[model samples]
Target: MSEAWNEGYFTDVGYTYGYYREINPVFQRFCLLLRGLAQPEPAEGTRHCELGFGQGVSVNIHAAANPGRYVATDFNPAHAAHARRLAAASGSEALLVDESFEQLLERDDLPQFDSISLHGIWTWVSRDNHEVIAEFARRHLKPGGIFYNSYNCFPGWSPAYPLRQLFALHDRFGVTPNGAVERVEAALKFSEALLAANPNYLKAAPQLTERLKSIATQNRHYLAHEYFNREWNCMYFTDVVDALAPAKLDWACTASPLDAVDAVNLAEPAQTFLKGVDHPILREQARDYFVNQQFRKDLYVRGAIRLSVAEQREHLLDTRFVLTQPADQVPMKVTGALGEASLQEDLYKPFIEALAADACAPKTLRRLAAGFSGMAWPVLQQIVAVLTGMGAVAPCQPESAEREARTRCRALNRHLCERARYGNEIEFLASPLTGGGISVPRFQQIFLLAREQGRKQPAEWAQFAWGMLDAQGQRILKDGKALESAEENLAELTTQAGEFAEKRLPVLKALGVV
Candidate 1:
């Protein structure tokens, strides 16, 4: 593998096979709708693009689960190949390219994108690459299209910047000619030793101790790319706003749904102070400092359209939502910049229970609101927003879109489950209901595979899964310890299979993944 093609980007190891939901167009539209901003619908002919789509997990899933055309690029050929494989498996109309940002900028055939997204990219590339992206967006993004950009931001990264620099420095100067993984381990070791020395820097940045400790335990591949990269720039929120201004972008709202809720993230005084700040940029920057914000998932609009209160209410009522997790598993407390706050039980309890009813099928806000005769529309909307922000509930695509996506999602999910028989690297399945990926661990995926093959009982699913694992000489790990014998492993699998059948299968069925 040659390094020249990667520019300064780290290509020593493939990036993680993680699915980020923020890249989903359905999720992005909901984020905008939450802030009373208008975004393009995820209609059949809509176009979306993702720059630096690492493992292509999100792009593929979105392509399969949503009714749209997806075009994505990652400089890494290995990533592009893996992504393309998933695209092929799902029979999705996704164009995954192995082209640099500069190359992508030179292309004239790209369609006008309704949404353009780049996650964990802005801060890791050079200023020139940033310009290329802006130019790309300027030329290709349609008017009123959404542009999602997530990056490591300032003030919050202020304390940890030095630590990252140390890791990069160690990898550059102190490490020997070892593999990327070994080099990462060595850099972590050096950082740990330096922190153990209890230097003055550690005393000034007390958080560094815990941060370093946490870093040591993270995936080496992630650490290598995250810290050992040659170009890592942590910018402020305002800087990003300015950088993308060339593309006619206006800051719309955060892709993080929870940030929309002021009560969870901002105190009354802080909120008042931010409100008094007349400039949007200045207010956003001040809010970041107030929250000590680090990484941000932001959605920008080329031509911003503010929805009227009545219009916002109308659109929200038409939108559909589904619970992403089991109702009982969703915690009543949500943590934000203000720490943990308890959700109003009287408001959320009945709502969650109601959502969980009807076999946990997707429900329109209007229908759900009808069930709560006494609750006001505003209160119901707020409750939906808070639950959505908590990640327990998720907005769904239009019913027509979901129906169109079922074949693609099932194909993609079957491919994922088949892959799970060998490895657990990819741990999510595309869900047409939510228009995103759902967390289905490898065993659960195997269980789904068994069900697909006409296995009727959980016991049969357990046996089927056990057969696959036992052939691979793998044992069931219960509570961090591997089962010693076949009977123990089968017993553990049986219990898991039963729980999966009882808890997750119905939801998966509703999501059209089963």
Candidate 2:
């Protein structure tokens, strides 16, 4: 722990633009449904909390998009302010606290959370913080509540272990007293230079050299948080399970729907070997080894009451889905540990097409299945699950939360779109339909804002954005080169805006991104 930094976790530059869908209850539950797991729905005004809610993007979006009460804390007041600002902009009553984990755990007035999520911060803090978090989960999380924890795990980060240490050590002893980012940049250059020296360590770990190269191209702020931190630990699956055991939180299925399918994550031999081992935690560790899984996004439950098979089928059938992207545009090829698996066109094409048509009024699995004829419940579930996991589709929110979420989303999006004029640090907009954030790029956000302010044509939208850019002395970059002429930049913006109007406008309207 550096005496200069008061906050335990990295806060010098804050976290990068990241949104984890596992934090959204609607999407998270929908993912759980795919694995035949039962998660309690938002009935009792489902109270939720996220520890170290970086930028508060995930929690703010979740609060705005769902009809639940959210209470989240980030130690850094700066990060908390950003989260609070977004929450306020959305008119959401999300309580964002700038308090440490220990402070939060010591508070007695806080409500017990129905669900809790902490992503990317677990291994970055000291063991004391980890213990505080576990205690917080044990005390503040209600029985049967789901806990989401994502961290840099072992086997995957194995090759880069020494490289991370090298960067941190270099930054500590050699770098000038400029700031974290410059120190990180210097450390990166030093590491690359060392790799050029062709040392025995670099020879033994060829992957670390490639990792160092990749880091140089990444955001230095992100690099500062990821590798420049003093307290960083990447543990194995068993370590996480052991840490959370006192909280009575057992490992549930992974939050990723694609990972529910064994065929993709494990090789055939590994899959066969896993079947014999009945201990869930050990089995997962074994799978992690097989896939060399460096990171994990997992869902744990405290006294989970699993639904019966029939109940699961009925509930799944009742759930609805809308296509996020065009049916034809949805890539059939999905990449995972097994490399690339091709989705069967004959089966998936029709399913995707169905959702594409029903974007406005998404169809349930049972209703959608009727069109395919003879598609059984399990197969339908699998296909939809896989598609949702592939990021092509999303589950539709209940009608009760729809109007309220939309109102909040509209308010929040208006503020976000306004921010796009300056820069695109945030790359997500709250989607009322899915009760989650949608990946809307900066330009699209500007276009949506233009449309909202009476710019009917794409040319007009392009002109409006170009005016802002020119006024700010910002030029559009193409192929790592800025367009010298204003006319050339506007021409490029016009072409992109035109495509957005023709192709994406309808989908945005249907999904309520605008």
Candidate 3:
């Protein structure tokens, strides 16, 4: 039997350092604007709460990047303690606790939340927990506030459901020994051999084999908690809408802004056909069938207020943004329901070039529009919106958020870099300029830590990291094999350091991460 903690969710193996965009109030408002939905004003300085904040990476980063009075709860004490450690190190005043949803709702001292977000909370736990979460939203969330919820939705999950069940069954009844990771590997190994025998169901749905292969490469801790949980609910869009209705929550838009663009998300006839559906839930559910979306990140608003065209544009223009990647790196194509669609080069070229020219200095839509004078306002808005959704660009901290975020980011990043020498638990660092954490691989984290101690060149950075590893009595791995000697490890680090310096350093510098 599983532990009573988190209602049988894993506490033994902690969740990964995950970050979700919906938790950032600035980004949330931006995505809602992209979908033409009226959003509550929640810049830094507002109250935000995240339920089931696994590992607390997102909450901590957002807290460090903005001036928000943040609050979060993870039932697992280990997760909460780790999150609190990060907060304390960054000098963030975020109130992070280890409390269940029921206990939290009953607390009299907690403030009413301006925004409530749960990243994939709805898909993992019991229906009782789900209703409790809904009740928390109803009581604690202020009027006209935002609620971000992500989950496993049907049709997209239809193919993998049986495979998950197979893994779970093997864990329960089969002779599994030792830890969860061993059981997961054994279950997977058994499934592979059984499927190779060419059963009828396996033969019919070849997608199952592909899914298993993808699942094989994921973090074992993620897989264990995700699949081994007692309650693994994959509900339809309508089911989710109904579940939140009692909280007086109405679906506003997708938490991911890119999903709002119909041209990229759905093909012509199907997109046109779906437009005819008047009900929001039915329309969303119908779209899911077209895209075969396995996961969903949705935004709901309590008492949603619609924005006028002028008001919408005014709000969108005020949101500051920064370019995170090189102009040449931007993808020219996107996948739609019909097929892959190509983005027009002419429209994106000028914008990308302009952003690349300035690097880290975040510019507003109004400032960006001045450079693309030839392009119409709506077209520029649409392209930028799509690009932001695609992750080529991001909504950034306003002037008000920058100085404070930068200071906190430095403190948090230095702490994270130092921690990397000991373990690989945290792979994220706060960047006050970017107002978020970018994925910093363990190797790169070591490199950053080395660079901090007066190591200017990449080779020096490589040598410094090698010394740390050598001191730790650890060897570096390449192609799943540990190097034989310190010399070979140093050689490997040199190459990686050169590439990182050339490609990643500029972005990191702009983000105030280095």
Whole-model lDDT per candidate:
0.90, 0.85, 0.82
lDDT of 1 by residue, 219-313 (tens): 98998789888899899999999999999999998988778788889989999999899987798899998999999999999999999999998
Deviating ranges (above 4 Å) for candidate 2: 1-8
Candidate 3 lDDT over 163-237, as tens digits, reads 889888888789897787888899888888877788788766887887888988999989888888878899998
Candidate number achieving the greatest TM-score relative to the actual structure = 1
For residues 16-70, what per-residue lDDT tens digits would candidate 2 score against the true structure?
A: 7688888888887886777778867766378999998888888888899888789
Pairs that clash in candidate 3: none
Clashes of 2: 1
Best candidate per lDDT, number? 1
Tell me the lDDT of model 2 at 93.
83
Ranking by TM-score: 1, 2, 3
- Of the candidates numbered 1 and 2, which has the greater lDDT value? 1
- Runs of candidate 3 exceeding 4 Å displacement: 43-45, 335-341, 473-488, 495-503
RMSD of 3: 2.4
lDDT of 2: 0.85
